[model samples]
Target chain A: MTNEKNKKVVIVDYAMGNIFSVKLACQKVGICAIVSNDKKEISNASALILPGVGAFADAMATLEKLDLVRTIKEFIASGRPFLGICLGMQLLMSESEEFGLHKGLDIIKGRVVKFPAVNDKVPQVGWNQITKPSYSNINWEETLLKGLSEKDFMYFVHSFYVLPNNNNIVVSETNYAGLNYCSSLREKNIYACQFHPEKSGESGLLIYRNFYNLINK
Target chain B: MKNIRIIPRLDIKGPNLVKGIHLEGLRVLGSPEDFAEHYYNAGADELIYMDVVASLYGRNGLMDIIEKTAKKIFIPLTVGGGLRTLEDIKNVLRAGADKVSLNTIAIKNPNIILEASRRFGSSTIVVSIEAIKQNDGKYMAFIENARESTGVEVFSWAKKVEELGAGEILLTSVNNEGTGSGYDIELTRKVSELVSIPVIANGGAGELEDVVNVIKQGKADAVSLASMVHYDYVKKSMVNGSLLKNQAEGNIDFLKFGKISEKIETSGIEEIKFYLKDKGINCRK
Candidate 1:
């Protein structure tokens, strides 16, 4: 991992995310991350990170304008490690119902839906604990949950959540206002978390470390 | 369950960090970088940098400080004060700030919230409301560092900002600010309950209990502190004249003569978290 070739990670920049914080987070973990919208740079990277913080429809429009949608699909199809954060994770779903109907990357069979108008806050901002599936036999310690406790808190700021058709891909869940929502998902080489690891303090940094280690493995 | 965020709000006047009583009589503390790093190391959930005199000084002047801190500090950095235009917000975000908080400008032009939120997402936009309790018990929103009243009620204004697409609300009590008496629980609770977005309680947190009360009773999602964390540090530094040296060189030493310290010990972020945890409050350990 110390070698220059193995230390590179590309953060997809479609002009709609906290690219700076994502790059800084990767740098904190000893990974040289480049924020690029170029297909060549993204495709040539060792691992790709998709980070976002905005409306899903607007993000999709920007990605389409940049013509990086097909590029992302090809990169993910290559079986390389891919990680998505927050809205970036939602973009992989089939569609989103934020303001109106919108299509997503459709790499995963899910739809992004707004949280039901309950008594809880709309965005569900701040730090919330992530709880792993109770009945799953999968060892989360070997993956992104490595070096993290079962209920460790992570920073989150989102008004919508992803509802995947397949529960097996769901890695962890978080409860807000007595409602359980998907917090993270894992499907082979592709991983995504709704929380912001870069902003989650030491626990967040450890998550990034684990993701980096996964890439190395 | 989401854990309450503990934030260290640093009020900056030029390069030096300063604190005031009731938002008056400014006293320079140590460097912003040092205090930021110290709080980050001690386990702060987030940081808010408010340029106290940015409006009076003509522009947002913490870009260098923000850049320096953003390079090492990984937590979310929110910058407030003197951010009026979309370009100013862009520059701050480009300098590595995660969020840009608006106050006076938002009142002057409410469409900025809509436009900025459209350009940079709602989560990146925060509306800071400084509320002062009026004679009739209603809280009125004040802008320009709480120097002028907007004649707008805090509750309706917060709701309006949320409707205008603001991601978060930072509600500060002008009466309780720098007093270290405690948060205006009623004011905080009123605003927090009125808005659907996350509300951050600012002004008046004297101890850990005060923070707990604000979260439990006031229902604030996050708590911001300046005097609670920096008062002792600024007081001690003033007495020892260690802070005076930095000011002397900058010709800003006249801001230090009013306050003195009798207390020697200051609580760090860790201590505050521990105290909160002991009271059965869930905070990041």
Candidate 2:
């Protein structure tokens, strides 16, 4: 039986990230999300969404200052559905090379790295297609990208990308300026992507809908 | 190849969305929220909201409009004008803007570009350059609604901003802005070639071919349009009367009485994308 206890989706707000847009995206999909850094509120959430857009070191510093680093790690460890977008996804890595070398939450045993010097721009801004990974047997229908078509367009604005230690976690990959990289990943209860699904239009909304459905189920 | 983004730029005055020629002689279109929502639904790759008078008046008031639009529109929103400090950029981003464009202050004090890019991430900081082709064929950067000249050359400024860690550059050709003639190909090409960061070519998209030429010849990573798409959206809204709302803002008289001339050749976002695709130019589909 679904009750109020089972419906809470907490968007961890540690004074960074586009919290409003994430909250509004949830609202559009009929999931009321509370943007908070409160330990109790976040720990008690049925589902947690970690959304951010900024430097990795600064984001990690702020999360540490707000005392949310441990709270978030614990929340993910609890096996409740966890979602991370953009920088939030990168934070799941063990470390990132942005600005200077810095450690991450190490939730997924991955490393965040910058796009190698290429003919294209640094931050792969605007809409780019995400294709299902060929190496992984993971089905899109069983993850956050459940209803998205193969090679569907999603909005992206980032300078760095994540490299998971294990390929099994990666759900989708995107090609940018000849650099085919991991775009999204699904690992047990953890869902993360380098693109901002909230700003990805109809296909993006579907991602939120899928996450919402996952929470209730 | 990365898809070329087709961005619809809306210039705002007070409460209404306005359009002007060469960034002057403002004419109110309608509510920006209406246009933003229309473009978002119509499949715009991205949307740029420029507060034209915000810098001149010494205040930035797009927070409310951004908040209201961000509630419904599920696309990246770039807010520009009068963002003089990191606090202003932070507040706007908090209000739901994915990126903040700095023009006047970026030229006045270039250090802010470095500071903002570092603090907010380079991708979140966009440096918009308003360029006017001078007699010597050199593009000179302008500020304060193109009323004041910064006396700096556009090419150098583009490189400097990139060196300062700016993720992208919004290069608007004052010579071609709102004229519906075409983009300044030479100017766009020079800037795009000078910087590694993505350059969004703004102003002078009179037709679909103009859009294609800018990307193919000019090498612009994206195109920012105002008159071409704004007029088309306004014209269509006139027929359906769907974009009009009761709340009054800016100059609503255009929506009330003004008529879009037949000579105002325009194209929708989808049509532009289709045309770009037909020409073998990859755009958002």
- The candidate that wins on DockQ is 1
Give Cα-based local distance difference scores for all models.
0.86, 0.87
Off by over 4 Å in 2: A1-6, B55-61, B240-264
The worst-scoring run of ten residues by lDDT in candidate 1 chain B lies at: B257-266
lDDT of 1 at A15: 78
What local lDDT score does residue A31 receive in model 2, on the 0 to 100 scale?
89
Residue-wise C-alpha lDDT for candidate 2, range A1-217, written one tens digit per residue:
3385349899988656578889989999988789888999999889999998778888999999999988998998999999999999999999999878999998889799888777677778888999978786778888899889988999898878999999988899999867789999988889999898999999999999998888877
Compared with the true structure, what per-residue lDDT tens digits does model 2 show for residues B3-120? Answer: 8998999988877788988898888888889899999989998899998888555343578898898888999899997778889998888888888899999999999999888777
lDDT of 1 by residue, A17-109 (tens): 588888888888877788999999998888899999999989999999999999999999999889999999999999999899999999999
CA RMSD of all predictions: 2.8, 2.3
Candidate 2: share of reference interface contacts reproduced = 0.67
Clashes found in each candidate (C-alpha, N, C closer than 3 A): 0, 0
**Model 2, residue A5: what's the lDDT?**
33
